[model samples]
Target: MVSVHVTTEVFPFDQSVDLCPDNDALNFTTIFLITFGSGPTLFSNKTPADFNFTTSHSQSFTFDVNDGMFAFVNEVPDLNNGWHGNASDYTTNDTDGYMFLVNMQGIDPQIFNYKIDDLHIGRLYEFSAYVANVVRKEKCLNKPNIRFEVRAINESGNVIAKKGTGDVPACYNMSWSKYDISFETTHSSVVLLMLSNVAEGSGNDLAIDDIELRVYSTNDLDDTSTTASSIFDCKNNDEDYCECSNDFIGLSCKIQSDDVCSKHDNNTYESLFFITFGSGSDRFYSKTASDFNFKTDLKKESWSNFKPGAYAFVNSVPSSLTVLWHDAAKDHTTNDTDGYMYLAGVGNVNDMIFNYNITNLCVGVDYEYSAYLTNVMRDIRWVSVTEPNIRFEVRAVHKKGDLIAQKSTGDIPVYQHMTWSKHGLSFVATSSSVVLLMISNVGGHPGNDLAIDDIQLRVSSANQTGFCYPG
Candidate 1:
C-alpha cells in the first residue's frame, strides 16, 4: 500500500497519464493530476468510454460517458459561426487537444462521479469549470444546460453540505465561460463530486473542460472590521441611528423599509368621517324609525347625516322577523373586535339606500370609502325564487349633487353565507368642502339581502390613486 499526503496544490495534467498499464499509471492520490485525452503515443478514441481509477486513499473515481450522449472531440463542430471554434476555448493552460462534448439528451445522459476523502469541516471550498455551448444554425432547437454539483456526506449517508451551479444555459456564439460555486462543509469525511447534463431531450449540446477545486481558510475571507464599520456608519442626514442601505430601517438597521403612505399608517388613517357602527353612540341604525332623516338634525349615534349644509339618509328599519343588528359574537363573526354590530336589509321596490354627506375634505386629494358587507339569508325560501346575483354600488357626489366618481361591486354570486366581504371605492375630491357618499343596492330582487358595517372615508396615499370618470 502507498501512502500519499494530500496538500493544497494546483494540478494541471499536461504530461502523459493514463489508466492503461502500457502508459504511466495515474496515482491520482499522489500525483494530484489527471486528464482525459490521447497523447502523441495513443490514437484518439472517439467512441464513448469509461475511465475508472482508485486514489491512494482507497476512494474510487469513475468518468463514464453514455453511448450516444457524449464524445471526446478534438474541435468544436462547424456551426453557428463556430461558437466554440477556438482551440483554447475553456482550458486554463490554452493547450487543449480533446474536450468532453455532451449531447444533453439521449438514451442515456452524460455523468461523472468522483469521491474525495478527508475534507476539512466548516471550511469553504470553491469548485469551478470551463464550459461552452455548441450552437447549431439549423433551427437551434433544444439548447444544452449543465450543472456541477458537490455534496459532502457523512458515514450515515446523510448529506451534510451541498452546493452546485444550479444550471448554466447555452451561450450562443459566445466564448467559453468559467463558472464557480462555493460551499462550506459540515462533515469532514468525504465529498462527492458529480457533473451532469441537465438539458432536456435532444438538441442541447455543450462541451466541458478543465475542472478545478480550491479550499479557502477563514483568514482568507474579507476583513470583518470593514463590514462592521459600514453597518454602524451613520449619515448626517439620516434620522435613524444607523444609516442603513438597501431599504433597511430602524436603529440597528434590522427592519426592512416598506412603502409608506404619507397620510396613513398601518393601523390608522387620516379620516374626515368614519363609523364602525359598533356599540353605543357610534351605532348608525334605529329600531323605531322607518328611515333616518338626516335633513332635520344629526342623530346622536350617527357620524354623518342629512343636514342644512350636508344631507344623509338610510331606508333602514329594525324588524323582529329578521336577524338585524347584534354583536358579532351573538350570531355573526365580524372583522372588528367585540361588540361590532351590523345593519342589514333586503332589496325591494324602494332599494335599501345608505347615503351620507362628508364636508371639509381636501380638494384634489384622493379618499377611500369602504364598508363591509355580508350575504344574509334571513329567509332561505327567497333564495330559490330570486336571481342568485347581488350587486351594490357606491357613488361620490358634490354638495350640489354633482357626481364626482362612482364604483360598483359587480354582480357577485351568492355563495358564502354570512361571510363578511369588503367593497370600496376610491375617489378624488373635486370640491374641497362637501362630498356625499351614497351606497345602494342596485340588484332589486326580493331575496338580495346583505349586512353593512364599518363605513369609513379616509385620505388615500401611496398607490391609492382614485379612478376618475373615463371618457
Candidate 2:
C-alpha cells in the first residue's frame, strides 16, 4: 500500500467555487431503467375469471375447505354464522351464484398469486377488490389484511413493488368495501402479481371478490420511448415522482383526491344528514316521522296514483302494479335486497317530494348535496310518456326568500337496465342553515313515478376553481 499524503497547500483554483457540487450527471439514478411507452391500451382483469392463475411462486396453499362456506348472492349469510355480508359479491349480483368463503388458519399467508403477461413496459396498473371483515366484534383481533406485490418475471426479477391493506374494520353488520394499490412495470413485459397475508394474529378470515387490474397511466411519469441504464434521479423513497393534476394524488397519481365527507373516494363518508332510510340484517325496516325529519308522511298505499306528497319506503319494485316500470330488487347504495328506497307517486306539478332543514352548517364552507333517483318508466314504452324531472334547491332556512343554489335532474329517462342517477349541486353556505328541497318539476299519474335513495350533504373537498379541474 502506498503512503497517503496529507497536503496542507492550497490548490491553485478559485476558493469561492463549490468543490463538491451536486454533480447530477454522475448521480446514481434508476429512472432510465424502464423505457416508458406512449398510448398503452387501458385494460381490466388481465387474469382469468376470479384470479384462476396456473402460475404462482409456490404451488402449495393451506386454504381449509372445512371453514370455507358458500352462499347465494342475494341471500343472507345466516348459514355461516353471518360471517359474510347480507349482500355478497358486488359484481355478480345473481341470486343463483355463490361466493366462495375463506379460512383464517393456514401454514403460509401467501394464498393467491397471478402472473400478468401482456404489459406495456413502463406502464402503471392498479389492482383492486372488495374486502370484508367477518370477525363480528368491536375491535379487530384476527382481521385479514392483504399485501400486494408486483414482480417482473421476464427480466432480472429485481423489481419489488408492494402495498398493504390495513386492518379491515368490521361494520358490525355485514358490509363490503373496496381497496386498491397501484404499481408501474419496468423493462419486463410480464409481471407476476402476488397477493399475501400480512396480518399479526390468527383468524385471517376475509371475504374477497371482484379482482381487477386496470391501467392508471399509459406511460411512466409522462416519459415516452426513452430509457437509459441510470439517467435522471426521478424517484423519492421508492415512489415515482409525478406531476399529477390536483384531483389525483399518491405516488402513481392514480388515486382521486377526496375527504372524510365523500363516499366516491371509497372512504367513510361523513355528512351532516346521513339519510340511508333504514338498515337491517335482511329485512325491510319501516320508518317513522323522525326518519324523514318530520317533513313528509308515508302513504297508506304503495301503488300508483296515491296523492301529492305521498311516498312509500319499498325495497323491491312490484312490476305487477306498473308493467311499464323497471323491476329493481336491490337498492342503489347497498345493493341489498332488503335496503329501502323512497318510491314517489307524483300527483301535481311542482309538488315537494321531500324537504328537510339541515342545521349546524359551517359558514363560508363549500358543501355537496346529492340524491340518487331512478325513473320508473321503462325505456321500451309504446306511448310517448313524460320522463320524471326533479328540481333540487337549497334555501336559507332563516330567510325563506334567500335561495342559495338550485339544480334540476332534467328529464330522467329510463334505460333498458335499471340505473340510478345522482341529482344535486354544490354550494358555499352563506348562512348557518339551509332548507334542502326535492320537488317534482313535472308530475302525472303514469309518467312521473320515480325511486329515490341515499340523500346526503357532505363537505365539498374538490373545487373546479383550482388547477385540478380544467386539467
Candidate 3:
C-alpha cells in the first residue's frame, strides 16, 4: 500500500502520480491509495494533516500494484479551450507557476508528466482514474468520449492482458471507471493500462475522479440438471379408453391381459350364421359345418309309381330382394309315391305337378327361385311331341298366388340317358307374400322321376358403406 499527505501555502492547480504493478509476482491481496483536488497536487513525504495550501489543495500517492492489479491517476480538461493543471513544488517568488494545465477536455487531450512502473500477472486487480478540464481558450471537440484499459505481461516483457480500443464514457463531474484486471497465466507476459479521450468535440468541460486499485482471487459458484424423465400408465378394461404408453414404443393395442392378441392389433371377432324358419318340417344337412349347400325339396318315393294328393311345402322369410331356391318334387326315396301330385298325358302332351310354396317372405321384397334337378328317372319310349317338347313346366305366382314367371325343360325320350336340369323363374312381389311354384308337363309323356339338390338365397349390396374393416 502507498500513502501520502499534502499542505500548501497557496493552492495552485491540480496534480497526480501513477503506480503500475507486476501481476505475475503477486499471489493475492494488494491495495492502493488515491487523492484528488481542484488546486495544486502534492506528493511529498508528508501526511495529509500536515499539508497546507490556500485556494485549493490536493495530493496523489503512487504504489506498485500486482500484474493482476495496478494503480494509476487520470485527469480530463474541464473546458473547451482554457487551461487547467496541478502544481507540485511552488516557489515563494511566484515564478515557476504550476504543472502543465490541461487546455481543453475534448479532441486529443494529453496526459502530462505521468509515468508508471511495476506490474504483475494472473491476479485479480482493481483500477480507477479521474480527470478535470478547463475550456476557457478553445472549443472542445465534437462528442468527447473517453475510455480506460489494462494489460498484464511476463518478465520477458511480453504483454499478457490488454483492453480493446473501445472508449469508456466520462461524466462532467469527474466520475471514475473502476474494474478488476487479471492476466491469463498461459503465453505472453506484461501488464499495463491506459486512459484516453474517445473521439472529441463537446461544449461542456469534463473530469475524472477517485482512482483506486486492489487485488485478490475470484470466487466460485454452483451447478444443475439438463433433461426430464417421465412415464404414463393406463389400466381400465375399455377398448377405446386405453392409451399407447411409452413402454410399447408408442405402438397401440387393446390389452387383454397385459399383452395384446397377436394376430390383428385392435380388432375382435363376430359370429357367422343365422336362420329363421316359417313352415314345413324341413331339415338341412351339409357334409361339413362350413358347407353352404341346402337340399330344397321334400324327400319322396318313386315318380313312376304315382300316388294321389301327396305334396310338400317349403317356406322362406323374405328380408330383402334375393335369389332363392325350392324343390318341386323329389322321387329318390322309395318305390311308392303313395300320396303325390299326378303327371298325366295331355292333348298338349303336358303333364303338370301343382303347388310349390315358399310360404314366408318379407312384406315388400321380390324373390327369384330356381329348381335344379340332378337325377331324372325315365322309361324307354320317346315323348310324342315336337322338338324342345317338355314333359313339365314350372310357373310361379306372387304372394296373392298369381302367376309371375314360368320355365320348362325340353323333352327327352324314354330311351335317352338321364341328365340334370336346371329350371328357374324370376318374379317381383307387390307386397310381402308367399308364392307357390307349379310344374306342368305341356307337350310330353309324364312319369319321369327327378331328384333335386343344393339351394340358396342371397341378398347383395349395390353400393358400399363408408366404414372399412379396421384391419
**TM-scores vs. true structure, each candidate:** 0.35, 0.41, 0.24
Give lDDT tens digits, candidate 1, residues 90-117: 4444244556565555311324444566
Residue by residue across 327-384, what tens digits does model 3's lDDT show? 3333221233321211212223223333333433433332334333432333221221
Clashing pairs in 2: none
lDDT of 2 by residue, 1-471 (tens): 111121111112222321122322122111111001111221111222223333222211222123322211222344344354354443332333333244444322443555545555655555545566655533323455454456656545543344445344444454555554445556444443434332223445565554445453333332111110101111134442321222111112223233422334232434556676775543234565456683643353545544445677777665766677777545687755477777777766666777888666766666667778887767652334445666677789874447675545545665667787666656667777678887765544456788888888766444322111121
Ranking by TM-score: 2, 1, 3
Computed on alpha carbons, the lDDT of every model, listed in order, comes to 0.39, 0.48, 0.27
Which of 1 and 3 is ahead in TM-score? 1
Per-residue lDDT for 236 in model 1?
30
Top of the candidates by TM-score: 2
Cα lDDT of candidate 1 equals: 0.39
Query: TM-score for model 2?
Result: 0.41
Better of 1 and 2 by lDDT: 2
- Which TM-score value belongs to model 3? 0.24
